[model samples]
Target: MKLYKEKLLSELQLKRLGEHQYSCSSCSYLDKFLQPYWNWLVSKVPLWLAPNLITIVGLILNIVTALILVWYSPNAKDGAPRWACALCGIGLFAYQSLDAIDGKQARRTGTANPLGELFDHGCDSISTVFVALSACIAVQLGNHPGWMFFQCFCAITLFYCAHWQTYVSGTLRFGRVDVTEAQVTIMLILAISAIFGPDIWSTKIPGTVMEMKTFLMITACGIAAFVAQANISVIFTGGIGKNGSSVAGTSVLSPIIPFSMILVPAFIIYQKSTEHVYENHPALYILAFGLVAAKVTNRLVVAHMTKSEMDYTDLSLIGPTMLFLNQYFSTFITEYYVLWLCLVWVTLDLLRYCYQICTEICDYLHVELFRIPHTGNTNTKRISSTSTSGNTEKNGTNIRNNKPPRSKKK
Candidate 1:
């Protein structure tokens, strides 16, 4: 009767989680210039507003705008209204801004903890799904659905691998061109669609034969490849734990299995549907699978944060399983409708997982989800974002601090 009442964390998981501390490092190309803007913006946030609430608000803004795009161009074949394109850009910028500020807000309000790290990254996992899908639609990439699939799945994989290495090395690393650079690039693409119409992505280059969208796709995938390589380099170089073990003392390669399970099924389901389930509704199709990505990615983040081995059994698999089963049984159920059913199922599953997990974390840690612990200095002076950690925009919000932990008292 009470799904939220379910306990997702075991006693050992709780113990390890209590000992976890956030550690991450980022070297972004634009953090220096953007730091000033973020500092000025957070200064205006009411001290009384909870940091988690700020994160939720930003995620809502992103999801709502992304849904608006989906409603207008569900198939990704049609050109969305110019205003919607611009609105998506605005919404994404709002998300990036608020997300970056929430972590800083946590520190300012004296509330930065493992919960902030977990909460922020959880939102990022979901946001990454929507961000990739919205960008595909903004480019009207429906004509090249395969490329669109590549684009969306590529983003999901990048986010997953980012944390995978974090699990291995006990440090979240960001290259000079990472999440911030990617978000800004997509925002610029959305803005271009708004100004010149989605057709701009279809235009031919001046001297080359490559279409603008193809060019963009090549560039995005190339950068993703580079980032993924960086992650793998860390993995191959060995973990920070004893005998090159991951932080959890698990096999460095163990994470690959769980991530592949989520991804491989999506590909098989998409390719096997005789009813053209994906072609008819690319956005919905990806949203279904994307939620699955979000679910597992969150688990990986939790695994890293808790420094515990992850159990790969997830309820979100029910969604893709429904689709797989429907196709295997001679399409007893129409795939288009099954896709819808799948989307609804995954959404609820993700919600259920997050609710149960967050409740457990909050209770065990004695933390509040949407309220600051100590209320005072309704308008206290905030830290200068410029001098603070430059990579604060990566994890869930931004780059996490990489400073070594203070030695515990004897």
Candidate 2:
């Protein structure tokens, strides 16, 4: 079956990185000043280790850190333990360090490949959910459900948008203000929270009822909006106007399908967690964030590999729209029932898209998704293996036909 494209092309054919120089223009000054230290740390990692392995280790560390937070701080009310927060901070620092060095390591080892790029981005997606949920627990934002969801949504949306910029411009353009910068800043916040105590973020602003979480979420929203707009401007105006490439068009409402599947369930799950049955287990909310995070990541990865322009329609747009509308009608109708109906419709649509994308990728690559090697050598092997075996068999049969068969019979 023909998938999005035919004829398996090597990664070289799909090259998008011009000059192949990896630089983060929007990197925070913190990362910039610390570059020497990060370089020193990368130099220490043994040359024998694969960059992809380093990425996997970073992903594992992130998961472990998140698990520790959930175990220690089940409820936002109980507050995260000092030790737990410290452990998370350490893990975040380590993950960030490793993530940074992997590319350098790959370049040093001469193993830089498309698979490594895909692996790194995929892990980043998963880590986004874990880190966001951990932040919610650390800050006890679970008690403030809206803020908790908002943080997760904002973080995930920003992460996806960064990659979407790459899909549009054929280069990963880090905005003058970017997520990598925010990530380091967040690490600082985590460290501060660990040192001061979980209640630090909960402290009220002077002369106002709003807490730190509110201020932070609002600020995060502003940053996310700016970053998103910057990307959209590039996609619609700068890149497309120059190149004449446009994203695949679908019905206006179709873009909402995958997003609703994610956010609708998110609202339901958040509401249910607030109820008595799930109140103590706020990890349920984290799981909800994971669903949306995975969906966004999946979309980004597909766009990157297929080299297709991603539709500008994103869940981040719909989320705030629904959030605002919910406020006006919240008292008049049972939101749960409305969410339940949305849940059913969204789940069906999401599943359908997931199946289509998965199958298309598998068919296109002709390799197990997980088994695709970092080097494009696997494609070379598949293309030649059959011919190599056929030549061997043909040679053997000829030998038999000439005289080898008679010798065997005797």
**Candidate 2 Cα errors over 4 Å, as ranges:** 1-28, 205-210, 238-244, 247-257, 268-281, 308-410
Name the Cα RMSD for model 1: 5.7
The Cα RMSD of model 2 versus the native structure comes to 14.1
- Tell me the TM-score of each prediction against the true structure: 0.91, 0.67
**Which candidate leads in TM-score?**
1
lDDT (Cα, tens digit) per residue for candidate 2, span 1-410: 64233332335433431112221223234445555776798899887687667877977898798789888876666677788888887887778888777766655554444444555666677678777778778777878766666777767666665655444554455543554566666677678778998898888999999998778778877877887787667655534223444232222122335555556655664564323323444464445445445556656555544554444454433432342355455424344433333434433444455555444433433433333244555553332122122112122221110111101000
lDDT of 2: 0.55
- Model 1: how far residue 398 lies from native, Å: 8.9
Residues 1-410, candidate 1, lDDT per residue (tens digit)? Answer: 76333567887887677667566565666665687798888899988788789989999999999899989999998999999999999999998888878766765666655666777889889999999999999999988878888889989888888888888998777777888888899899999999999998888999999999999988987888898889899987859888898999988998988778878888888788788888888999999998998899899888887788887677778888898899899999999988888889989988988887888877776667898656553332231222144234443234333221110000
